[model samples]
Structures are given as structure tokens and as C-alpha cells.
Target: MKLFAVIGDPIVHSKSPRMHNNALQVLMKNAVYTRYHLKDNAKLKEIVNFFNGVNITIPFKEEAFKIADFKDKSVVDIGCANTLLNKNNKIYAYNTDYLGFLKAIDNFCNIKNALILGAGGTARALAFALKIKNIQVTISNRSSNRLKHLSDYECCLYSNLNLHKKFDLVINTTSAGLHDTDLPCNEIILKNIFSNARYAFDVIYGKNTPFLNLAKKYNLKTKDGLDMLLWQGVFAFELFLDCKKTKEIFKAMEIALKLP
Candidate 1:
């Protein structure tokens, strides 16, 4: 069977196997998807040698970008790599977060101005993607300290949102709302933000996060992380699957994700 996996430190929480393997089975493809809890970057070379392809997360995204023998310039510009494919003994990197992210937004209405929460690697790629589309980005977080190291784009704080300034889109790239106790923002501010947003996108796919639920309550179009996850996984799988088997793999993924 062809093999694939997603790598991260806290990989145990990943549902990628269920998602990807299900897709493979639905498409009648012979493949297995698993998760790897990599201890550190020291074993990156070994890891790459073993897997035909891998989905990277968090800390390893940057490392993947460095070790990749080939990469999309947009991903390179962001200094991160979430998807890696090994072909001809060379590593190829790409950033599906932006593409997947944009796709998730397509599920909603138009997005012109956006407010992104967080300033991490994914945030950087997302911001650049937005820039390419010529959309104005208003970044928000608890602190602006990290902004000094990132872009000089307009930055705001969750506590200081202009009650009058409305945005076309709101995205949550932060780890907030990942756990049961996590919420995207304070109740009052979240209400105000969603009141004006046409759509909301939360990068967390595990469940219906507070960020998404709140948007729903406000009657704004909202999407979970699943579509983004599926699109990115499908894109990453293409790096490994041949022309004939490619179609089957993604077909299977659709079935898996839609399964009850």
C-alpha cells in the first residue's frame, strides 16, 4: 500500500488518518495514512526518507521549508511548508493552507477586507495570500510584540476593535477555540466582530469552535476547518499518487469525511 502521514509534536490529536484513509478507500485506492509525533527536527532527514509524502504542522512547518529540495516560491516566501512530497529522492514543498483557506471562504460570500487572528507561520502565509488577492488585512492578537518581526500590516487588538469599523471577513488562525475551554475572543468583542462580518473562517477543524458557532448565531456564513483540511490533503496526496490513481484517492476522501 502507498503510505502517507502528517507530522507534528502533538500529532496524537490529528484526525488526518481517518480523513485521508477514508478518502483513499472510497476511491478504491490502496493507501494508508497515519500520524507521526516527531520528537524534534533532528530526525527530519530520516523521516523524509521513510515517507512518500507528509503533512506538516506547527514547529515543523518551518523546518520542512528549509529541508525541501524544491518549493513553491509563495510557500518559500512565507518561510513555512505544510505539505511535503518526496519524488526522485528530493523533497518538494507547498503551502496548501492559503489555497485551502481561500477555498473554505468560497463556501461563504465575498471576502474583501479581512481580520486575521494570530501571527504564526500559517498566519504569515494566509496574510501573503490575502495580499496577492489585494485584500486589506487587519491583524489582531493579544499583543503586537510579534508584529515587529512579521509584516508592517495594520494590527489591532481584540480589546480595542472599533465598534463602528466592519470587515468583510474574519479568520481565526490562533489556537484559541481549539479546546473545550477556548473561545475565539471575549464575548462582547466576538459579538461585535461577527455582527459586521459577512463570513468567518476558523482554521481549527476538530469541531464547531466557539468562533464558528458565534458567527452562525449572528447569521454570518461560517465554515469549519474540514474543507481546508480536505483540499490540502488532496493536494498533498497528488504529489505521491500517479495520474491514474489520483482521482480515486480524493474520491475516497470525500466519502470518508461525509461518513456518519
Candidate 2:
């Protein structure tokens, strides 16, 4: 069986193995997916020496981006990699975060105004994904200094979430809600945002987040990162299959990972 894994510093909580293994079983593919925790990002190269390829996650996405011999422009824009492919003798990296993010918002008809809650690599991918659709995206983060590279866009402090303007979409890209708790931001801010927001998205998926709960309380359409997680796996599986029985494979994955 071909070997694959998701690599990161803190990977114990990842459901990627369950998701991917389900997909493999549904598609009858000969593959094994696992998770590996690395103390250092530099160990990625050494790990790649054995495995065929691996998915990347937080804290290491940028490091994986740096080491990839070739990078898709989409991954370059995100400054990270969520999917890595070992092609020929070169390691290539791509970011399916946008693919998953795009799939999350594909059903939302109008998304002209949106609020993004972090300034990390996933946030960058989401911002560009929004920009691609010609939507205006405003980002709020703790320290606006590290976001100098994103200065060209409208950016502000997280405290300014109470501004009078109403957003059509609000996405929580921070790790804040992963532990089943909301960010330190006031509850009133979420009430204010989701009151007018049409949809909400949180990138943390192991469970329904406090952020999503607050959005749902306002009757706003909300989605966790789970579908994005599943679809990205579908996207990567297509690459892994190299066009062999693509539709059959994806349909099976979709059924196996069907969302409630």
C-alpha cells in the first residue's frame, strides 16, 4: 500500500486519518494514512525520504512551503502548503485550503462583504479566495504588525469588530475555537456581526465551535471546517490517483464523508 500521513507539531487531535482512511476504503484504494508529530519543521525533509507524500498543517505549512522544490501559485499566495506531492524526483506543494474554503462558500449566493479573523497562512488563502471572487475582505488580528505583507488589503485590530459596518460573511480562521472556546473577543461583537451576516465559517472542525454556536444563535447559516477538510482530501486524492477512475473515487469519498 502507498503510504501517506498528515504532519505537524501538534497532530494528535487531527481527524485526517479517519477521514482519509474512510475515503480509501470507500474507493478501494491501496493506501494508508497516518499522523506524525514532529518536534521541528526541519525534520519534514527527513520524513519525506520514506513516505510517498504527506499533508501539512499549522506552524509547518510555511516551513513545508519553503522546502517544496516546486510550488503551485495558489500555495505560493497562501504562503503555505496543505498538500504535498512527490512527483518524479521533485517534491511539489499545493494549498487545497482555498479549494476547501471555496467549497464551503460555494452555496452562498452573495458574499460582497466578509470579515476574516486571523492573519495566518489559512487566512491568506481565504483572503485571496475572496478576492478572486471580487469580494471585499477585511481582516482583524491581535497584532497588525506581522500582517505588513497583507497591508494592501483593508486590515484592522480585532477590537474594531464592533464597527458600524455589517458584513455579509464572517470566517473564524484562528485556532481560538479549536479547544471548544470562543476567542477573548466580547460576545456582543459576535452578536453584532452575525446579526447582519448571512453566513459563518470556522476553520477548526474536530467539533462544533463556540464561534459557530454564536453564529447559529443569530440564525446565520454556519459551517464547520469538516466539509472543507473532506473536499480537500478529495482534491488531493484525485492528484494521487493521476486521473485513474477519478469520478468513481470522488463519488465514493463524498458518500463516505457525507455531512449531516
> Per-candidate RMSD vs. true structure?
2.6, 2.4
Q: List the residue pairs that clash in candidate 1.
A: 23-252, 23-253, 27-252
Candidate 2 lDDT for residue 173: 87
123-147 per-residue lDDT for model 1 (tens digits):
8778877878788888887887766
lDDT tens readout by residue for model 2, 91-198: 889887888789877898878989998888888888988988899999888887747878647988878665678899999888888676666356777778778888
List per-prediction Cα lDDT, in the order shown. 0.79, 0.80
Q: Return the TM-score for each candidate structure.
A: 0.86, 0.90
In model 1, state the lDDT of residue 19. Answer: 73
Cα miss at 84, model 2 (Å)?
A: 0.8
Mark the regions of model 1 whose C-alpha exceeds 4 Å error after superposition.
Answer: 25-31, 159-163, 242-248
The whole-model C-alpha lDDT of candidate 2 against the native structure comes to 0.80
Poorest stretch of ten by lDDT in candidate 1: 238-247
Best by TM-score: 2
Name the lDDT of candidate 1: 0.79
